[model samples]
Each structure stands twice: as structure tokens, then as C-alpha cells.
Target: MTTQQLEVNFSELINKPKATLAGLAGAKRILLRRRDAEDLVITTAARVEQDAQVMSAGTRMFVALVRHDTAARSLLLEIIPEAFPWVRFLSEESVRAFAAELAEVLPAAESLGNMSAVATTIAAWQHTAEVHSDPELLAALTTDRGEDYGPVPEPGVTG
Candidate 1:
């Protein structure tokens, strides 16, 4: 399917909703750019559902191929570094582990119509590889400090 998206300032969406929506007549989606916050995508619920279905089908096809074909799995592992040069910072074992985890997460994320799981998995692995790439950071993180620190508070929560 062809994707047509138009970009407009977020203010245009808020101040001139009608004109902003008119842009959608020529494009399937509107990308609202926000200077101080994350950008947003505006599209019909039907378009969103169609995208989810396409993603689910494609993810399932890939999962099936990898499960049934050893060659496909090997090819995926072999191409990891090619696709993401940062993976080169990771050891072979870590790279394989990253691939395995990503493969496991992709289908589940797609089925849920949410890519957060897949994104989180990739970010975690990427952070691991980044740490591995730095000798000082890796040593500091891996070493035992032998000190009893206070209990850590939950992230994003304040006392």
C-alpha cells in the first residue's frame, strides 16, 4: 500500500483545525510537528487498523519463516551487524541473544498492535552493546562494588 503523509506545525492543527484537516484530503495521514514535545500522527481509525493488520501479517510471515527454516535464522543473525552497525560493538554471543529476544518480541508486539515491547527490547540490547563498547563503563558496571547501598526507589516516582 502507498503511504502519503503531510507535515504541518502543531499550532496549525490547534488554531486552524479545518484547514489542517483539509490537508488530509491529499494525504492519508497528517504529521503534527511539536517543537517542545513528541510529534503526533493523525489518521483515520480505519487507516490505523489497516496498518495494524499489515504489520501483523508481515510479522507473522517472518516469524514462520524463521521458525521453519534454519537458513533464514542464520541469515538474520548474519545480517544483524549489516543492518545495525552498532551491533558490531556487541560480542557474538550478545548479538545472538539480542536477535533471539527481538524475534520473540516482534510477533507479540505486532499481535497487540503496539510496538512498545519491540522498541524496549531493542533499546535495552542497544544500551548493553553501548556499555560493552566502552571499557571503563563496562568494567564499572560489571564489577562488584562490595557496598550495601540503600534500597532503590521506583523509577518516575518521588517520595
Candidate 2:
């Protein structure tokens, strides 16, 4: 780290009240870097200015599930696993943690969890399947000495 970077006290920096620093008052965003590659936190002016959504239906589910309030939690624990196989490894505590993070960031998240799934390559794979489904086109492309499937070359060139 540079001397300038090592000089600041991040703990105290973050402890400062909002709008306390005159120099940074006009800044649109701020970021704090922790030891080495350990952690990073960035807070935008807009994110801080916007209201946080603490109470929502999704958050209520997490709270209820964590407290084991009723049979509903049991149904969720079973149904979620059945619907999403990836949820199989997540215990109740892990699910609670995930839900907590989700709730905390949901408001700041730009997409509202529309296309958040990482395993969403099904559409790309489906397009590829459709492209290669025609046997005649596939055979024509693979055949070297037959009618060309794509643009044909000049007379002297090979097929």
C-alpha cells in the first residue's frame, strides 16, 4: 500500500456522520478499502439518499422461516428445495443469511432480481439446438465434396 493509503483510519472514517466532512460533502460517492484483498464497500450518494426498504413480503418470509413461526416455514423449506435443486445444500441458517443479504440489497439492486440467475444459459443452448436440428443443413455443412451449404468459392478453389 502507498503511504497515503496507510495513513487514513478506515474505522474512524466510516464512523464519521453523514455530511460531516466538508471536503467530501460535494462528493457523489465514497469507497472504503480494507486490509489487502479482504473487503471493499462502496456507497453512492444516491444509495444513501434513497430510503431503505426493511419491511417487505420477501423479508417477512425470511423472518418467519428463521423463527420457525409456523407450518408455513416447513412448506417453504420443502417446496424451495423441490423447485430449485441448488437450494438443497443451503441449511435453514444459510437460507436466512442469503435472504438477509437479499433484503438489504434489494432496494439498491437496479434490476429487482429479474435476470439474476447465473445458470440462465438455457435460452442460448435452446437457440443452438434449434440451429442444428435440421439434418439436411447439418449434412450439407459437414460434406466437403458436395453442394456448399454457405457461399460458394471461385472456380479454382476447393469445395
Candidate 3:
């Protein structure tokens, strides 16, 4: 499978009352806006799958590093309960710091500064994680189901 990266503006995608989304007419898309509606749209399902693998691999490495590395994770989690109010914030900050450290050795984090506001950025991250981490949450968010999830059972729970 092959994938192509397309640079597009949100204004262009949402130009009409129709969906610019994937279907018999188009390919899958990931909308990312960094500035002034500047967006990167991944317009192929195959590409999406490939990108997902790349992202997942990167995420796993990051988790492994922070989860296993003592000193690095400690500095960020010092206040534990204070500095990090949300998991997303912690992840973003960890990535930020890691990128900064990476920059010392190699130029990086060049675009991190252009990221959206902390609150909104963290919110989106948390929202996506929530949807992926829990099907019920995704269902509830996507479609209103009057049922409460009962604290969302722990992942992989066994009776």
C-alpha cells in the first residue's frame, strides 16, 4: 500500500455543505491545523494505516523510555499531582522536553512552539485517547447513549 501527503487548507475542505471526507468519492483523511488553517491532510486509507504504524511505533518507544528511564521521567513528574493535571499535558510536556533534549543533539522541536493552546491541544489529545482507549467512551461521545459507563471498568478486567 502507498500513501501520499497532501497540504490543504480547512477552508478548502469545508468550502461547501458537503463532506470532504473519505468514501466512494475520496480517501481517508487526517486533519491537522498548525496555523491560520494551515492543514496537512492524509488522503489515502493505505497511507493512514502506514502512518498509524509509524505513530504507534514512535508512541511505544516514547512510553518505554519514560516508563523505564528513571531520571528523565522524574524531573517531569516531580510535582506528580501538581505540574501534571492531565495525562495529555504530561505526554505533551514529556514530548516537548524530549524534543528539546533531542534538539541539543539534533535539530528538533522546530514546530512544537507553533502548537495550539495548551488547553485545547491537551483536550484534543485526551479526547482521541479516550475514544481509542474505550469503546464505550467513543460510543457515548459519538452518539448520545443515556447510559452511564459506571466509572469505565479497568482495561482488561477479569472477574
C-alpha TM-scores of all predictions: 0.85, 0.23, 0.29
Question: How many clashes show up per model?
Answer: 0, 0, 0
Please give, for residues 1-159, the per-residue lDDT of candidate 1 as tens digits.
544999999999999999999887788999999999999999989988898888888899988898899999999999999877889999888888988888899998887778999989988988888998999999999999899887888998886
**Any runs in candidate 3 off by more than 4 Å, and if so which?**
1-42, 75-121, 124-159
Assess each prediction's global lDDT (C-alpha) against the native.
Answer: 0.90, 0.47, 0.50
Find the 10 residues in a row with the least total lDDT in model 3: 106-115
Q: Give the per-residue lDDT of model 3 (tens digit) for 1-159.
A: 423333445664567315445421443454545466455654557765686566556655655566578775765455443533444433556545533343232212212322134345446645655565676766677896577756766789964
Predicted structure with the largest lDDT when compared to the true one: 1
lDDT of 2 by residue, 1-159 (tens): 211122223554668744333324444344454666554434445644352333344544565564565565555555654554454444567544444454344433423533243223334433434445666766676678855488879999997
- Give every collision pair in model 3: none
Model 2 regions lying over 4 Å from their true place: 1-35, 45-52, 55-57, 61-71, 80-159
What is the lDDT for 145 in model 1? Answer: 89
lDDT, ranked from best to worst: 1, 3, 2
Best by TM-score: 1
TM-score, candidate number 3? 0.29
